[model samples]
Target: MSEFDVVGIGLNATDTLIIVPHFPSYAGKGPFTHEILSPGGQVASAMVTCAKLGLRTKYIGTVGDDERGRIQIESLQGSGINLDHVQQRKGCQNQSAYIIIDQSTGERTVFWQRPDCLRLDPSEIDESMIKSSRLLHIDGHDTPAMEKAARIAREHGIPVTVDVDTIYKGFERVLPYVDYLIASSEFPIQWTHQSDPLKALELIQEEYGIHCAAMTLGAHGTLARVAGKFHYSPAFVVNCVDTTGAGDVFHGGFCYGVLAGWEIQQVLDFSNAMAALNCTAIGARGGIADKEKALALMARADRRVMDEIQRRL
Candidate 1:
Protein backbone atom coordinates (compact mmCIF):
# COMPACT_ATOMS: atom_id res chain seq x y z
CA MET A 1 0.00 0.00 0.00
CA SER A 2 1.14 3.57 -0.59
CA GLU A 3 2.30 5.58 2.39
CA PHE A 4 -0.22 8.29 1.57
CA ASP A 5 -3.62 7.69 -0.01
CA VAL A 6 -3.80 11.09 -1.69
CA VAL A 7 -1.67 14.21 -2.27
CA GLY A 8 -3.09 17.60 -3.25
CA ILE A 9 -1.28 20.52 -4.83
CA GLY A 10 -3.05 23.84 -5.35
CA LEU A 11 -4.45 26.76 -3.32
CA ASN A 12 -5.42 27.58 0.27
CA ALA A 13 -6.95 30.74 1.68
CA THR A 14 -8.14 32.25 4.93
CA ASP A 15 -11.67 33.60 4.58
CA THR A 16 -13.28 36.32 6.65
CA LEU A 17 -17.02 35.55 6.68
CA ILE A 18 -19.31 38.50 7.34
CA ILE A 19 -22.96 37.78 8.06
CA VAL A 20 -25.73 40.21 7.18
CA PRO A 21 -29.50 39.91 7.61
CA HIS A 22 -29.97 39.90 3.84
CA PHE A 23 -28.02 40.78 0.75
CA PRO A 24 -28.58 44.45 0.15
CA SER A 25 -28.91 45.98 -3.30
CA TYR A 26 -25.91 47.68 -4.87
CA ALA A 27 -25.04 50.92 -3.05
CA GLY A 28 -27.51 49.94 -0.28
CA LYS A 29 -26.30 49.67 3.31
CA GLY A 30 -27.15 46.98 5.87
CA PRO A 31 -26.09 46.09 9.36
CA PHE A 32 -23.73 43.15 9.56
CA THR A 33 -24.42 40.64 12.35
CA HIS A 34 -21.29 38.57 12.87
CA GLU A 35 -17.83 37.86 11.51
CA ILE A 36 -15.68 34.73 11.58
CA LEU A 37 -12.37 33.68 10.09
CA SER A 38 -12.31 30.28 8.44
CA PRO A 39 -9.81 28.25 6.50
CA GLY A 40 -10.81 27.16 2.98
CA GLY A 41 -9.64 26.85 -0.64
CA GLN A 42 -10.29 24.68 -3.67
CA VAL A 43 -7.75 21.88 -3.11
CA ALA A 44 -7.18 22.52 0.59
CA SER A 45 -10.82 22.07 1.54
CA ALA A 46 -10.99 18.89 -0.54
CA MET A 47 -7.93 17.52 1.21
CA VAL A 48 -9.54 18.34 4.52
CA THR A 49 -12.56 16.27 3.48
CA CYS A 50 -10.29 13.37 2.56
CA ALA A 51 -8.55 13.60 5.90
CA LYS A 52 -11.85 13.70 7.73
CA LEU A 53 -12.88 10.56 5.86
CA GLY A 54 -9.87 8.72 7.33
CA LEU A 55 -7.52 9.01 4.38
CA ARG A 56 -3.81 9.69 4.77
CA THR A 57 -3.47 12.96 2.90
CA LYS A 58 -0.67 15.36 2.00
CA TYR A 59 -0.90 19.01 0.98
CA ILE A 60 1.59 20.88 -1.21
CA GLY A 61 1.11 24.59 -1.74
CA THR A 62 2.39 28.05 -0.80
CA VAL A 63 1.43 30.40 1.99
CA GLY A 64 2.72 33.78 3.14
CA ASP A 65 4.18 34.94 6.43
CA ASP A 66 1.06 36.81 7.41
CA GLU A 67 -1.43 36.09 10.23
CA ARG A 68 -3.88 34.54 7.75
CA GLY A 69 -1.12 32.24 6.63
CA ARG A 70 -0.52 31.15 10.19
CA ILE A 71 -4.21 30.45 10.65
CA GLN A 72 -4.34 28.39 7.46
CA ILE A 73 -1.31 26.36 8.54
CA GLU A 74 -2.79 25.74 11.98
CA SER A 75 -6.01 24.46 10.45
CA LEU A 76 -4.19 22.01 8.18
CA GLN A 77 -1.94 20.85 11.02
CA GLY A 78 -4.96 20.34 13.24
CA SER A 79 -6.52 18.15 10.56
CA GLY A 80 -3.47 15.87 10.70
CA ILE A 81 -2.59 16.32 7.02
CA ASN A 82 1.09 16.17 6.08
CA LEU A 83 2.29 19.65 5.12
CA ASP A 84 6.05 19.14 4.83
CA HIS A 85 5.97 20.46 1.24
CA VAL A 86 3.88 23.58 1.96
CA GLN A 87 6.14 26.57 1.43
CA GLN A 88 5.85 29.76 3.41
CA ARG A 89 7.10 32.91 1.69
CA LYS A 90 8.35 35.80 3.76
CA GLY A 91 7.00 39.39 3.39
CA CYS A 92 4.01 38.24 1.41
CA GLN A 93 0.31 38.34 2.10
CA ASN A 94 -1.41 34.97 2.18
CA GLN A 95 -4.40 34.51 -0.13
CA SER A 96 -7.46 35.91 1.60
CA ALA A 97 -11.20 36.18 0.83
CA TYR A 98 -13.78 38.53 2.24
CA ILE A 99 -17.00 36.47 1.99
CA ILE A 100 -20.21 38.28 2.72
CA ILE A 101 -22.92 35.74 3.69
CA ASP A 102 -26.58 36.57 3.74
CA GLN A 103 -28.16 35.21 6.89
CA SER A 104 -31.54 34.80 5.24
CA THR A 105 -30.49 32.78 2.20
CA GLY A 106 -27.09 31.47 3.32
CA GLU A 107 -25.62 32.58 0.01
CA ARG A 108 -22.31 34.43 -0.25
CA THR A 109 -20.54 37.10 -2.29
CA VAL A 110 -16.76 36.94 -2.23
CA PHE A 111 -13.85 39.26 -2.90
CA TRP A 112 -10.56 37.38 -2.87
CA GLN A 113 -6.93 38.30 -3.53
CA ARG A 114 -3.75 36.26 -3.98
CA PRO A 115 -0.37 37.91 -3.93
CA ASP A 116 2.10 37.14 -6.74
CA CYS A 117 4.68 36.45 -4.06
CA LEU A 118 3.00 33.14 -3.26
CA ARG A 119 3.13 31.65 -6.76
CA LEU A 120 4.31 28.04 -6.88
CA ASP A 121 7.00 27.55 -9.47
CA PRO A 122 7.38 24.21 -11.26
CA SER A 123 10.94 23.86 -9.94
CA GLU A 124 9.64 23.61 -6.38
CA ILE A 125 7.69 20.37 -7.02
CA ASP A 126 9.96 17.40 -6.40
CA GLU A 127 9.55 13.80 -7.58
CA SER A 128 9.28 12.37 -4.07
CA MET A 129 6.00 14.14 -3.34
CA ILE A 130 4.47 12.93 -6.58
CA LYS A 131 5.55 9.30 -6.23
CA SER A 132 4.68 8.83 -2.54
CA SER A 133 0.91 9.06 -2.93
CA ARG A 134 -1.54 6.58 -4.39
CA LEU A 135 -3.54 9.38 -6.04
CA LEU A 136 -2.88 13.01 -6.97
CA HIS A 137 -5.42 15.86 -6.89
CA ILE A 138 -4.99 19.41 -8.07
CA ASP A 139 -6.64 22.61 -9.29
CA GLY A 140 -5.68 24.80 -12.26
CA HIS A 141 -4.52 27.82 -10.29
CA ASP A 142 -0.78 27.55 -11.06
CA THR A 143 -0.63 25.98 -14.50
CA PRO A 144 3.12 25.35 -14.61
CA ALA A 145 3.25 23.85 -11.14
CA MET A 146 0.16 21.70 -11.78
CA GLU A 147 1.56 20.50 -15.11
CA LYS A 148 4.78 19.48 -13.44
CA ALA A 149 2.93 17.53 -10.74
CA ALA A 150 0.65 15.86 -13.28
CA ARG A 151 3.60 14.77 -15.39
CA ILE A 152 5.34 13.25 -12.41
CA ALA A 153 2.18 11.41 -11.34
CA ARG A 154 1.75 10.05 -14.85
CA GLU A 155 5.31 8.80 -14.90
CA HIS A 156 4.67 6.84 -11.71
CA GLY A 157 1.43 5.30 -13.07
CA ILE A 158 -0.59 7.14 -10.46
CA PRO A 159 -4.04 8.49 -11.31
CA VAL A 160 -4.55 12.24 -11.47
CA THR A 161 -7.83 14.05 -10.73
CA VAL A 162 -8.29 17.73 -11.48
CA ASP A 163 -10.88 20.21 -10.22
CA VAL A 164 -10.95 23.04 -12.70
CA ASP A 165 -13.55 25.82 -12.67
CA THR A 166 -12.04 28.34 -15.04
CA ILE A 167 -10.09 28.17 -18.29
CA TYR A 168 -6.51 28.81 -17.31
CA LYS A 169 -3.87 29.65 -19.88
CA GLY A 170 -1.79 26.60 -20.89
CA PHE A 171 -4.40 24.33 -19.31
CA GLU A 172 -4.29 22.12 -22.41
CA ARG A 173 -0.79 21.10 -21.42
CA VAL A 174 -2.12 19.69 -18.15
CA LEU A 175 -5.27 17.97 -19.49
CA PRO A 176 -3.48 15.20 -21.36
CA TYR A 177 -1.87 14.01 -18.14
CA VAL A 178 -5.14 13.88 -16.19
CA ASP A 179 -7.06 10.60 -15.86
CA TYR A 180 -10.16 12.24 -14.40
CA LEU A 181 -11.31 15.70 -15.45
CA ILE A 182 -14.04 16.85 -13.04
CA ALA A 183 -14.96 20.46 -13.54
CA SER A 184 -17.78 22.93 -13.07
CA SER A 185 -20.59 23.05 -15.65
CA GLU A 186 -19.33 26.33 -17.05
CA PHE A 187 -15.82 25.02 -17.67
CA PRO A 188 -16.71 22.37 -20.29
CA ILE A 189 -19.01 24.77 -22.14
CA GLN A 190 -16.36 27.47 -22.12
CA TRP A 191 -13.51 25.11 -22.95
CA THR A 192 -15.26 23.44 -25.91
CA HIS A 193 -17.70 26.21 -26.90
CA GLN A 194 -20.46 23.54 -26.94
CA SER A 195 -23.84 24.61 -25.69
CA ASP A 196 -24.94 21.15 -24.65
CA PRO A 197 -23.21 19.87 -21.49
CA LEU A 198 -23.28 16.22 -22.57
CA LYS A 199 -21.78 17.14 -25.93
CA ALA A 200 -19.16 19.27 -24.22
CA LEU A 201 -18.23 16.39 -21.96
CA GLU A 202 -17.95 14.02 -24.89
CA LEU A 203 -15.75 16.43 -26.83
CA ILE A 204 -13.42 16.96 -23.89
CA GLN A 205 -13.17 13.25 -23.11
CA GLU A 206 -12.55 12.35 -26.75
CA GLU A 207 -9.97 15.10 -27.23
CA TYR A 208 -8.01 14.45 -24.01
CA GLY A 209 -8.53 10.66 -24.13
CA ILE A 210 -9.10 10.74 -20.39
CA HIS A 211 -10.85 7.88 -18.61
CA CYS A 212 -13.65 10.09 -17.39
CA ALA A 213 -14.97 13.61 -17.99
CA ALA A 214 -17.50 15.06 -15.55
CA MET A 215 -19.08 18.30 -14.32
CA THR A 216 -20.88 19.37 -11.18
CA LEU A 217 -24.28 21.06 -11.56
CA GLY A 218 -24.87 22.99 -8.35
CA ALA A 219 -28.42 21.96 -7.37
CA HIS A 220 -29.00 19.40 -10.11
CA GLY A 221 -26.24 17.08 -8.90
CA THR A 222 -23.46 15.74 -11.21
CA LEU A 223 -23.07 14.52 -14.79
CA ALA A 224 -20.31 12.44 -16.32
CA ARG A 225 -19.20 10.31 -19.24
CA VAL A 226 -17.59 7.05 -18.14
CA ALA A 227 -16.73 4.04 -20.29
CA GLY A 228 -18.53 5.79 -23.18
CA LYS A 229 -21.79 6.01 -21.19
CA PHE A 230 -23.50 8.99 -19.60
CA HIS A 231 -24.29 8.87 -15.86
CA TYR A 232 -26.16 11.49 -13.91
CA SER A 233 -26.46 11.74 -10.14
CA PRO A 234 -28.77 14.20 -8.48
CA ALA A 235 -27.91 16.29 -5.43
CA PHE A 236 -29.38 15.24 -2.08
CA VAL A 237 -31.79 17.46 -0.20
CA VAL A 238 -30.64 19.00 3.06
CA ASN A 239 -31.22 22.12 5.12
CA CYS A 240 -28.66 24.27 3.47
CA VAL A 241 -27.04 26.96 5.63
CA ASP A 242 -23.97 27.70 3.56
CA THR A 243 -22.72 26.26 0.26
CA THR A 244 -19.14 27.49 0.33
CA GLY A 245 -17.30 24.17 0.14
CA ALA A 246 -19.93 21.88 -1.36
CA GLY A 247 -18.16 21.38 -4.67
CA ASP A 248 -14.76 20.87 -3.07
CA VAL A 249 -16.22 18.31 -0.70
CA PHE A 250 -17.92 16.61 -3.63
CA HIS A 251 -14.55 16.15 -5.32
CA GLY A 252 -13.13 14.66 -2.16
CA GLY A 253 -15.99 12.20 -1.95
CA PHE A 254 -15.50 11.29 -5.59
CA CYS A 255 -11.83 10.64 -4.91
CA TYR A 256 -12.82 8.34 -2.06
CA GLY A 257 -15.20 6.47 -4.33
CA VAL A 258 -12.53 6.07 -7.01
CA LEU A 259 -9.98 4.76 -4.54
CA ALA A 260 -12.53 2.37 -3.07
CA GLY A 261 -13.32 0.89 -6.48
CA TRP A 262 -16.99 1.77 -6.32
CA GLU A 263 -19.16 1.71 -9.44
CA ILE A 264 -19.64 4.93 -11.39
CA GLN A 265 -23.25 5.36 -10.27
CA GLN A 266 -22.29 4.68 -6.68
CA VAL A 267 -19.44 7.12 -6.95
CA LEU A 268 -21.70 9.89 -8.19
CA ASP A 269 -24.37 9.13 -5.57
CA PHE A 270 -21.87 9.03 -2.70
CA SER A 271 -20.22 12.23 -3.85
CA ASN A 272 -23.58 13.97 -4.08
CA ALA A 273 -24.51 12.82 -0.58
CA MET A 274 -21.30 14.19 0.88
CA ALA A 275 -21.59 17.56 -0.85
CA ALA A 276 -25.20 18.03 0.22
CA LEU A 277 -24.44 17.37 3.87
CA ASN A 278 -21.63 19.93 3.80
CA CYS A 279 -24.07 22.72 2.91
CA THR A 280 -25.86 22.61 6.26
CA ALA A 281 -23.20 24.62 8.09
CA ILE A 282 -21.47 27.99 8.18
CA GLY A 283 -17.94 27.59 6.82
CA ALA A 284 -16.76 25.72 3.75
CA ARG A 285 -15.56 22.73 5.79
CA GLY A 286 -17.85 23.14 8.75
CA GLY A 287 -20.34 20.44 7.67
CA ILE A 288 -18.14 17.58 6.46
CA ALA A 289 -19.85 14.38 7.65
CA ASP A 290 -18.32 11.24 9.02
CA LYS A 291 -18.85 7.93 7.22
CA GLU A 292 -21.83 6.90 9.27
CA LYS A 293 -23.48 10.30 8.93
CA ALA A 294 -22.93 10.35 5.19
CA LEU A 295 -24.31 6.83 4.81
CA ALA A 296 -27.34 7.68 6.86
CA LEU A 297 -28.05 10.69 4.68
CA MET A 298 -27.55 8.60 1.57
CA ALA A 299 -30.02 5.99 2.75
CA ARG A 300 -32.76 8.44 3.67
CA ALA A 301 -32.14 11.44 1.48
CA ASP A 302 -34.53 13.12 -0.96
CA ARG A 303 -33.17 12.88 -4.50
CA ARG A 304 -36.21 13.69 -6.64
CA VAL A 305 -34.43 16.62 -8.27
CA MET A 306 -31.53 14.37 -9.19
CA ASP A 307 -33.91 11.70 -10.54
CA GLU A 308 -35.23 14.22 -13.05
CA ILE A 309 -31.68 14.92 -14.24
CA GLN A 310 -31.09 11.20 -14.73
CA ARG A 311 -34.34 10.97 -16.70
CA ARG A 312 -33.02 13.56 -19.10
CA LEU A 313 -29.89 11.59 -19.73
Candidate 2:
Protein backbone atom coordinates (compact mmCIF):
# COMPACT_ATOMS: atom_id res chain seq x y z
CA MET A 1 0.00 0.00 0.00
CA SER A 2 1.20 3.51 -0.71
CA GLU A 3 1.96 5.79 2.21
CA PHE A 4 0.16 8.68 0.54
CA ASP A 5 -2.90 8.77 -1.68
CA VAL A 6 -1.97 11.88 -3.63
CA VAL A 7 1.46 13.44 -3.91
CA GLY A 8 1.48 16.93 -5.39
CA ILE A 9 4.60 18.44 -6.93
CA GLY A 10 4.23 22.04 -8.06
CA LEU A 11 3.70 25.67 -6.98
CA ASN A 12 2.11 27.51 -4.07
CA ALA A 13 1.45 31.21 -3.75
CA THR A 14 0.24 33.80 -1.27
CA ASP A 15 -2.55 35.76 -2.96
CA THR A 16 -3.76 39.27 -2.23
CA LEU A 17 -7.47 39.40 -3.15
CA ILE A 18 -8.96 42.81 -3.86
CA ILE A 19 -12.77 42.76 -3.86
CA VAL A 20 -14.32 45.38 -6.06
CA PRO A 21 -17.95 46.23 -6.70
CA HIS A 22 -17.41 45.62 -10.41
CA PHE A 23 -14.56 45.24 -12.82
CA PRO A 24 -13.52 48.68 -14.02
CA SER A 25 -13.17 49.61 -17.67
CA TYR A 26 -9.51 49.12 -18.70
CA ALA A 27 -8.71 52.83 -18.26
CA GLY A 28 -11.35 53.57 -15.61
CA LYS A 29 -10.65 53.91 -11.91
CA GLY A 30 -12.66 52.22 -9.16
CA PRO A 31 -12.61 51.87 -5.39
CA PHE A 32 -11.83 48.46 -3.98
CA THR A 33 -14.08 47.32 -1.14
CA HIS A 34 -11.69 44.97 0.63
CA GLU A 35 -8.23 43.42 0.61
CA ILE A 36 -7.22 39.98 1.90
CA LEU A 37 -4.11 37.87 2.06
CA SER A 38 -4.79 34.24 1.21
CA PRO A 39 -2.77 31.08 0.68
CA GLY A 40 -3.33 29.33 -2.66
CA GLY A 41 -1.67 27.76 -5.73
CA GLN A 42 -2.32 25.17 -8.41
CA VAL A 43 -1.04 21.88 -6.99
CA ALA A 44 -0.68 23.06 -3.39
CA SER A 45 -4.28 24.17 -3.02
CA ALA A 46 -5.46 20.96 -4.74
CA MET A 47 -3.46 18.93 -2.23
CA VAL A 48 -5.18 20.81 0.55
CA THR A 49 -8.54 19.87 -0.90
CA CYS A 50 -7.46 16.26 -1.14
CA ALA A 51 -6.42 16.40 2.50
CA LYS A 52 -9.80 17.83 3.42
CA LEU A 53 -11.45 14.88 1.68
CA GLY A 54 -9.60 12.51 4.03
CA LEU A 55 -6.89 11.59 1.58
CA ARG A 56 -3.36 11.07 2.87
CA THR A 57 -1.65 13.80 0.87
CA LYS A 58 1.83 15.29 0.53
CA TYR A 59 3.12 18.45 -1.16
CA ILE A 60 6.52 19.14 -2.75
CA GLY A 61 7.35 22.69 -3.80
CA THR A 62 9.49 25.76 -3.16
CA VAL A 63 8.60 28.92 -1.29
CA GLY A 64 10.64 32.00 -0.46
CA ASP A 65 11.73 32.69 3.11
CA ASP A 66 9.36 35.60 3.52
CA GLU A 67 6.12 36.44 5.35
CA ARG A 68 4.05 35.18 2.40
CA GLY A 69 6.02 31.99 2.41
CA ARG A 70 5.43 31.60 6.12
CA ILE A 71 1.69 31.99 5.56
CA GLN A 72 1.71 29.31 2.86
CA ILE A 73 3.63 26.87 5.09
CA GLU A 74 1.29 27.46 7.99
CA SER A 75 -1.76 26.93 5.81
CA LEU A 76 -0.46 23.68 4.36
CA GLN A 77 0.63 22.45 7.78
CA GLY A 78 -2.81 23.16 9.18
CA SER A 79 -4.48 21.25 6.35
CA GLY A 80 -2.86 18.01 7.55
CA ILE A 81 -0.67 17.77 4.44
CA ASN A 82 2.85 16.39 4.61
CA LEU A 83 5.22 19.16 3.58
CA ASP A 84 8.43 17.31 4.36
CA HIS A 85 9.54 17.80 0.76
CA VAL A 86 8.75 21.52 0.59
CA GLN A 87 11.82 23.76 0.30
CA GLN A 88 12.18 27.30 1.54
CA ARG A 89 14.65 29.32 -0.50
CA LYS A 90 16.82 31.95 1.16
CA GLY A 91 16.53 35.63 0.09
CA CYS A 92 13.73 35.08 -2.39
CA GLN A 93 10.25 36.53 -2.42
CA ASN A 94 7.30 34.15 -2.37
CA GLN A 95 5.02 33.87 -5.40
CA SER A 96 2.30 36.51 -5.26
CA ALA A 97 -0.84 37.71 -7.10
CA TYR A 98 -2.97 40.80 -6.88
CA ILE A 99 -6.42 39.52 -7.84
CA ILE A 100 -9.19 42.01 -8.50
CA ILE A 101 -12.51 40.25 -8.02
CA ASP A 102 -15.65 41.83 -9.38
CA GLN A 103 -18.24 41.23 -6.70
CA SER A 104 -21.08 41.79 -9.14
CA THR A 105 -20.22 38.77 -11.26
CA GLY A 106 -17.87 36.75 -9.09
CA GLU A 107 -15.14 36.93 -11.73
CA ARG A 108 -11.53 37.98 -11.21
CA THR A 109 -8.60 39.57 -13.02
CA VAL A 110 -5.21 38.43 -11.79
CA PHE A 111 -1.77 40.07 -11.88
CA TRP A 112 0.92 37.74 -10.57
CA GLN A 113 4.67 37.19 -10.34
CA ARG A 114 6.91 34.20 -9.64
CA PRO A 115 10.62 34.80 -9.18
CA ASP A 116 13.26 32.54 -10.70
CA CYS A 117 15.15 32.21 -7.44
CA LEU A 118 12.33 30.12 -6.00
CA ARG A 119 12.10 27.80 -8.99
CA LEU A 120 12.29 24.13 -8.09
CA ASP A 121 15.26 22.47 -9.68
CA PRO A 122 14.89 19.05 -11.32
CA SER A 123 17.79 17.78 -9.21
CA GLU A 124 15.94 18.58 -5.98
CA ILE A 125 13.28 15.98 -6.71
CA ASP A 126 13.74 12.68 -4.87
CA GLU A 127 12.37 9.62 -6.66
CA SER A 128 11.38 8.00 -3.37
CA MET A 129 9.21 10.99 -2.45
CA ILE A 130 7.06 10.52 -5.57
CA LYS A 131 7.12 6.71 -5.49
CA SER A 132 5.66 6.71 -1.98
CA SER A 133 2.29 7.91 -3.26
CA ARG A 134 -0.44 6.04 -5.10
CA LEU A 135 -1.29 9.00 -7.34
CA LEU A 136 0.66 12.02 -8.56
CA HIS A 137 -0.72 15.53 -9.09
CA ILE A 138 1.29 18.29 -10.65
CA ASP A 139 1.24 21.69 -12.33
CA GLY A 140 3.13 22.97 -15.40
CA HIS A 141 5.50 25.26 -13.54
CA ASP A 142 9.03 24.13 -12.81
CA THR A 143 8.68 22.14 -16.02
CA PRO A 144 11.80 20.00 -15.81
CA ALA A 145 11.15 19.03 -12.20
CA MET A 146 7.53 18.07 -12.91
CA GLU A 147 8.63 16.15 -15.98
CA LYS A 148 10.94 14.12 -13.79
CA ALA A 149 8.27 13.58 -11.18
CA ALA A 150 5.69 12.49 -13.76
CA ARG A 151 8.15 10.06 -15.29
CA ILE A 152 8.93 8.63 -11.86
CA ALA A 153 5.21 8.09 -11.24
CA ARG A 154 4.84 6.45 -14.63
CA GLU A 155 7.65 4.04 -13.87
CA HIS A 156 5.99 3.17 -10.56
CA GLY A 157 2.63 2.54 -12.34
CA ILE A 158 0.90 5.31 -10.44
CA PRO A 159 -1.57 7.49 -12.31
CA VAL A 160 -0.55 11.11 -12.90
CA THR A 161 -2.99 14.02 -13.07
CA VAL A 162 -1.93 17.52 -14.13
CA ASP A 163 -3.59 20.90 -13.61
CA VAL A 164 -2.19 23.48 -16.01
CA ASP A 165 -3.79 26.86 -16.67
CA THR A 166 -1.41 28.09 -19.32
CA ILE A 167 1.33 27.02 -21.68
CA TYR A 168 4.77 26.38 -20.25
CA LYS A 169 8.09 25.87 -21.98
CA GLY A 170 8.88 22.16 -22.42
CA PHE A 171 5.35 21.24 -21.34
CA GLU A 172 5.20 18.68 -24.13
CA ARG A 173 7.64 16.44 -22.30
CA VAL A 174 5.34 16.35 -19.28
CA LEU A 175 2.03 15.80 -21.14
CA PRO A 176 2.73 12.27 -22.36
CA TYR A 177 3.21 11.09 -18.79
CA VAL A 178 -0.08 12.59 -17.69
CA ASP A 179 -3.03 10.20 -17.47
CA TYR A 180 -5.47 13.01 -16.90
CA LEU A 181 -5.06 16.70 -17.80
CA ILE A 182 -7.44 19.38 -16.49
CA ALA A 183 -6.53 22.79 -17.87
CA SER A 184 -7.91 26.30 -18.13
CA SER A 185 -10.37 27.22 -20.90
CA GLU A 186 -7.67 29.01 -22.85
CA PHE A 187 -5.03 26.30 -22.54
CA PRO A 188 -6.45 23.87 -25.14
CA ILE A 189 -6.86 26.62 -27.71
CA GLN A 190 -3.45 28.08 -26.96
CA TRP A 191 -1.62 24.76 -26.96
CA THR A 192 -3.27 23.13 -29.99
CA HIS A 193 -4.07 26.35 -31.86
CA GLN A 194 -7.45 24.74 -32.62
CA SER A 195 -10.49 26.98 -32.33
CA ASP A 196 -12.84 24.26 -31.15
CA PRO A 197 -12.32 22.86 -27.64
CA LEU A 198 -13.56 19.41 -28.62
CA LYS A 199 -11.04 19.21 -31.45
CA ALA A 200 -8.31 20.55 -29.18
CA LEU A 201 -9.09 17.90 -26.58
CA GLU A 202 -9.08 15.21 -29.23
CA LEU A 203 -5.73 16.39 -30.58
CA ILE A 204 -4.12 16.55 -27.15
CA GLN A 205 -5.24 13.12 -26.01
CA GLU A 206 -4.36 11.62 -29.40
CA GLU A 207 -0.86 13.08 -29.57
CA TYR A 208 0.00 12.66 -25.89
CA GLY A 209 -1.76 9.30 -25.51
CA ILE A 210 -3.50 10.66 -22.41
CA HIS A 211 -6.55 8.90 -21.01
CA CYS A 212 -8.42 12.15 -20.55
CA ALA A 213 -8.03 15.74 -21.79
CA ALA A 214 -10.23 18.30 -20.03
CA MET A 215 -10.69 22.03 -19.45
CA THR A 216 -12.53 24.05 -16.82
CA LEU A 217 -15.10 26.56 -18.08
CA GLY A 218 -15.23 29.12 -15.32
CA ALA A 219 -18.83 29.60 -14.04
CA HIS A 220 -20.11 27.20 -16.66
CA GLY A 221 -18.43 24.12 -15.23
CA THR A 222 -16.07 21.59 -16.91
CA LEU A 223 -15.64 19.81 -20.24
CA ALA A 224 -13.61 16.71 -20.97
CA ARG A 225 -12.95 14.05 -23.57
CA VAL A 226 -12.30 10.61 -22.15
CA ALA A 227 -12.17 7.37 -24.12
CA GLY A 228 -13.58 9.00 -27.24
CA LYS A 229 -16.51 10.58 -25.39
CA PHE A 230 -17.24 14.14 -24.27
CA HIS A 231 -18.77 14.99 -20.88
CA TYR A 232 -20.05 18.39 -19.88
CA SER A 233 -20.81 19.34 -16.28
CA PRO A 234 -22.59 22.61 -15.58
CA ALA A 235 -21.85 24.92 -12.66
CA PHE A 236 -24.10 25.36 -9.66
CA VAL A 237 -25.52 28.81 -8.99
CA VAL A 238 -24.30 30.25 -5.72
CA ASN A 239 -23.92 33.51 -3.87
CA CYS A 240 -20.29 33.83 -4.82
CA VAL A 241 -18.14 36.16 -2.73
CA ASP A 242 -14.86 35.34 -4.41
CA THR A 243 -13.77 33.31 -7.41
CA THR A 244 -10.09 33.26 -6.44
CA GLY A 245 -9.68 29.60 -5.49
CA ALA A 246 -12.51 27.96 -7.38
CA GLY A 247 -10.29 26.35 -10.01
CA ASP A 248 -7.80 25.09 -7.44
CA VAL A 249 -10.59 23.53 -5.43
CA PHE A 250 -12.06 22.08 -8.58
CA HIS A 251 -8.82 20.29 -9.37
CA GLY A 252 -8.69 19.02 -5.83
CA GLY A 253 -12.21 17.67 -6.15
CA PHE A 254 -11.28 16.07 -9.44
CA CYS A 255 -8.35 14.33 -7.78
CA TYR A 256 -10.70 13.02 -5.16
CA GLY A 257 -13.05 11.73 -7.84
CA VAL A 258 -10.21 9.98 -9.59
CA LEU A 259 -9.10 8.23 -6.42
CA ALA A 260 -12.66 7.27 -5.52
CA GLY A 261 -13.24 5.62 -8.90
CA TRP A 262 -16.12 7.84 -9.90
CA GLU A 263 -17.61 7.86 -13.40
CA ILE A 264 -16.66 10.76 -15.65
CA GLN A 265 -20.03 12.53 -15.42
CA GLN A 266 -20.15 12.23 -11.66
CA VAL A 267 -16.57 13.40 -11.41
CA LEU A 268 -17.32 16.61 -13.27
CA ASP A 269 -20.50 17.23 -11.27
CA PHE A 270 -18.79 16.68 -7.94
CA SER A 271 -15.85 18.84 -8.92
CA ASN A 272 -18.14 21.60 -10.11
CA ALA A 273 -20.02 21.49 -6.84
CA MET A 274 -16.80 21.68 -4.88
CA ALA A 275 -15.69 24.71 -6.88
CA ALA A 276 -19.04 26.46 -6.55
CA LEU A 277 -19.08 25.99 -2.81
CA ASN A 278 -15.58 27.45 -2.46
CA CYS A 279 -16.61 30.61 -4.28
CA THR A 280 -19.17 31.34 -1.57
CA ALA A 281 -16.51 32.63 0.82
CA ILE A 282 -13.69 35.18 0.98
CA GLY A 283 -10.53 33.22 0.20
CA ALA A 284 -9.22 30.40 -1.92
CA ARG A 285 -10.08 27.76 0.65
CA GLY A 286 -12.78 29.68 2.44
CA GLY A 287 -15.61 27.41 1.38
CA ILE A 288 -13.95 24.03 0.84
CA ALA A 289 -16.71 21.54 1.68
CA ASP A 290 -16.58 18.03 2.96
CA LYS A 291 -18.13 15.23 0.94
CA GLU A 292 -21.47 15.63 2.64
CA LYS A 293 -21.64 19.35 1.95
CA ALA A 294 -20.57 18.97 -1.64
CA LEU A 295 -23.14 16.24 -2.21
CA ALA A 296 -25.82 18.36 -0.64
CA LEU A 297 -25.01 21.22 -3.00
CA MET A 298 -25.08 18.88 -5.92
CA ALA A 299 -28.50 17.56 -4.89
CA ARG A 300 -30.12 20.89 -4.14
CA ALA A 301 -28.53 23.80 -5.98
CA ASP A 302 -29.73 25.17 -9.30
CA ARG A 303 -27.23 24.71 -12.10
CA ARG A 304 -26.23 27.68 -14.21
CA VAL A 305 -25.03 26.93 -17.72
CA MET A 306 -23.99 30.12 -19.44
CA ASP A 307 -24.31 30.70 -23.17
CA GLU A 308 -20.77 29.43 -23.56
CA ILE A 309 -21.92 26.04 -22.36
CA GLN A 310 -25.17 26.21 -24.31
CA ARG A 311 -23.33 27.00 -27.50
CA ARG A 312 -21.18 23.94 -27.06
CA LEU A 313 -24.20 21.75 -26.41
The whole-model lDDT of each prediction reads 0.92, 0.92
Model 2, residue 286: displacement in angstroms?
1.1
Give every collision pair in model 1.
Answer: 234-306
The residue pairs found clashing in candidate 2 are: none
- Candidate 2 minimal-lDDT segment of 10 residues: 304-313
Q: How many backbone clashes does candidate 2 have?
A: 0
Candidate 2 per-residue lDDT over residues 207-281, each given as its tens digit: 999998999988888889999988889899999888888999999999999999999999999999999999999
Cα miss at 224, model 2 (Å)?
0.8
Per-residue error at 36 for model 2, in Å? 1.3
Error of 2 at 65 (Å): 0.8
